[model samples]
Target: MWQIAVVLFGVANAVQVDFRPYDHSAELLFNGSDFNHDHIFSRQELEQEFQKYDADGDGRVSRHEYTTYVTTSVPELHDFAHALYDDYDVSGDHHLDHHDYDMYYAKLDADSDGSVTRQEFVDYWVKLFQATEHLHGHGHSGHG
Candidate 1:
């Protein structure tokens, strides 16, 4: 049942986009799952997000750069932001755009609700980062 959910969740997240999970073992970060760690948002995802949020096309993001992240009683918006924030803030720029937002929102909104909530953040991250249980140990264990 859990495995089914994982597969379905992945399929759902990638509804309209073509996201290829990278070779995570190659990078050795091991967010506790998969060779690509793509089940969660990968660096590729962050870059894409950066491009999206960089509204000025300046090629760099300013700190706390404001953008839209809508919410409703339906939930999912907050959850999507939680899942993506730190990760998508590549170069530590600390901001995101519709590209990054949409990418992760899609991931969290596995059922395609057009929004995300806090619980979805925990659930999706748990599956992508913990469900596969790919972590090994210490400062780094899987790298070779």
Candidate 2:
């Protein structure tokens, strides 16, 4: 009887485990950026979205501005903002401008297409978060 109970407990634990990665921040970002409610994220929409992070109307997003915006707007992602900012700051100039946005957009587009679908956006961000979490040995518990 004890062995049977132990087996049932193991099955319950297995059922509770989810290996799939989900990033709530990515979902929020996709919803916010899909301004036209068209399900697809176009480059124009992305450019407009990126502008919000500039904060100072400087046509560029500094590390401080980016961090502050993420912390305040997407608090759940605040922990990974630095990593995301670093990834987007391709030029290593500590500021994100059109060049960086363009490059990042291209990356998110995934298929060299001009637009990004919700799946592509979420998948990329989830992978990024997973990589960051692995590096830091911590997990983000935010759920969408």
Candidate 3:
């Protein structure tokens, strides 16, 4: 379902050439899903996005900088940014350098081989879907 679309979008977005397989349906495909710019960022795009958060052009994003980026760019996750920072900032230095970014992807590596292939990324989403599906409609009180 959504996982399939994510892999498709990931591959399409990763291509350097002008080929855009998902352009036609990108909105219809991802409008309601949590899949966003981050999910489809190519290796280059990921680096660019990291640089966006790396204020002062220091090549590293401090926790405060990342929190600010998330606050302005994706406010829905701002409250959780610190948790994400804790997860991605592996060195405990409260900053995310290139290696820390690599560690972020490695968390999704699935196989621990130091890289996150498309398949691994899609699998991770699928598993996350499965794990969260049961909680989707259970919290509502149905009073509205």
Number of the top TM-score candidate: 2
As a TM-score, model 1 comes out at 0.28
User: Deviation in angstroms for 20 in model 2?
Assistant: 8.7
What are the candidates' C-alpha RMSDs? 16.3, 11.1, 11.4
In the predicted model 2, the residue pairs found to clash are none
Root-mean-square deviation of Cα positions for candidate 3 versus the true structure, in angstroms:
11.4
Clash counts per candidate, in order, are 10, 0, 0
Total residue pair clashes for candidate 1:
10
1-144 in candidate 2: lDDT tens per residue?
A: 001111111242221112233456567667877889999988888778778778899899999998887666334345457887888888899999888888888889888878899999988877875677643224423422
| CA deviation > 4 Å runs, candidate 2 | 1-25, 73-79, 134-144
Candidate with best lDDT = 2
| Rank list by lDDT | 2, 3, 1
Query: Model 1 over residues 1-144: C-alpha lDDT tens digits?
Result: 011122111233322111113132222322332224434544344345355445577765443332232122212223333433555543344655445455555766566765443344445655544322322111222333
At residue 66, candidate 2 shows an lDDT of 85
